[model samples]
Target: MTPSPATAAVRVRRAELSDLDDLVALEQATFDHDLVSRAQFRRHLDSDSARVLVASANHRRFLGTALVFFRKGSRVARLYSIASLPEARGKGVGTALIEAAEAAARQRRCQSLRLEVRIDNESAIRLYERLGYRRIGPVEKGFYEDGSDAFRYAKTLA
Candidate 1:
């Protein structure tokens, strides 16, 4: 049994077609803009270079999801999106997803993982930093749907 963000054991695994609803639900519940559509989730689940990982407990309730895009002909994997239930914050859901993403990237022979977080998302920034991801590039202007800027971050895989 996997431990849930709240109390149960959490399990991280590759997403399946049945996971579309939960994936969309998490996407809608997490970000205010640039949401991942149901069609997109299906496409990602079928794509070879894209991965949608889900974290759940007892295969019942979902805890979080992470979307990773692997660049062809490149050693970089992009952590395009990652989000956990509000109650899952600071409960290792994000960390588990990140670790799974890193493993997925490494399995694909990726050398580094990269992502962009809204400049105003201090908690996310702190999480990335705490996980050893360093700021890589300049803050992107008008990055989000609400025109919020974003900070680029990256971490080299061992």
Candidate 2:
């Protein structure tokens, strides 16, 4: 089934404490390795260097989440994590989240956005490539808790 027009109208916004439960559930549902704990999420939610963006439908229900990290005195920002419900995949939700992350990074005066993805995730790699991110260098060994390697990618913001 396809999403309704209303469901397709996803709003990306800064996440609040109220969305903690949904964010935790999303993390569990989306990854098998390198999971972010609730405590870590809480810390990021409160951290000045990190920004959490949530994609919501009807401004009430969260469909996806993305986290971006910025470093002081650095021009590069990291797209730390992003995930959408299986039902929301292929519906432009992930793209929306990425665009939001880039915007957030730009707002913070970042010159580029970077992210690391499992080397085996071809679909995600394609998505990143389609969005103008390119591989920065050789894949890193043991990048995840399960020892999966990852490819680092980066995009320069206009």
Candidate 3:
């Protein structure tokens, strides 16, 4: 049988130890360079300063994941990473994860949500802009392991 489309319906929640494998697979499949290591993901799961949100269809099959990082004595939250399966692209999986991240940031009293996307990620750029993120222009040169430039974007929370 075919899998459900993430856009049809999605469930977003905090990542648990059981979700480590799926999260790692999604990250590996979604990113080519600057990939998040499994060890880092494990650390994030147990870190209070970070929120690891996972998205799934029917609360079973994993569709995507998003990570939000918070720092003490700061009102800004950074969206460290996000990933979705190829079949989940153009669906609501990515959007749902991002919104979840924003909500998590707000819960932590963040004034804004910031992220850096690869320069070549036009699709992601469009999505971020559509979600009300303002472009902060290009970040440091060769920010990725593959020497790719990245663009910074942020959305202020009301």
Predicted structure with the largest lDDT when compared to the true one? 2
lDDT of 1 by residue, 33-107 (tens): 999999999999999999999987655467899999997898999999999988878887887888889889999
List the candidates' TM-scores in order.
Answer: 0.91, 0.92, 0.90
lDDT of 1: 0.88
Runs with alpha carbons beyond 4 Å of true place in candidate 3: 1-8, 137-139
Ranking by TM-score: 2, 1, 3
> Candidate 3 on 39-153: residue-level lDDT in tens?
9999999999999998887555678889999999999999999888888778788888888888889888999999998888899999999889998865768988989888999
Q: 39, model 1: CA deviation in Å?
A: 0.4
Residue 144 alpha-carbon offset, candidate 2, angstroms: 1.0
**lDDT of every model, 2 decimals:** 0.88, 0.90, 0.86
Model 3, poorest ten-residue lDDT window?
1-10
Worst ten in a row by lDDT for model 1: 1-10
Clashing residue pairs for model 3 = none
Best by TM-score: 2
What is candidate 2's lDDT per residue for 68-153, written digit by digit as tens? 99999999999989999998888778888888898889889999999999999998999999889999999899999999999999
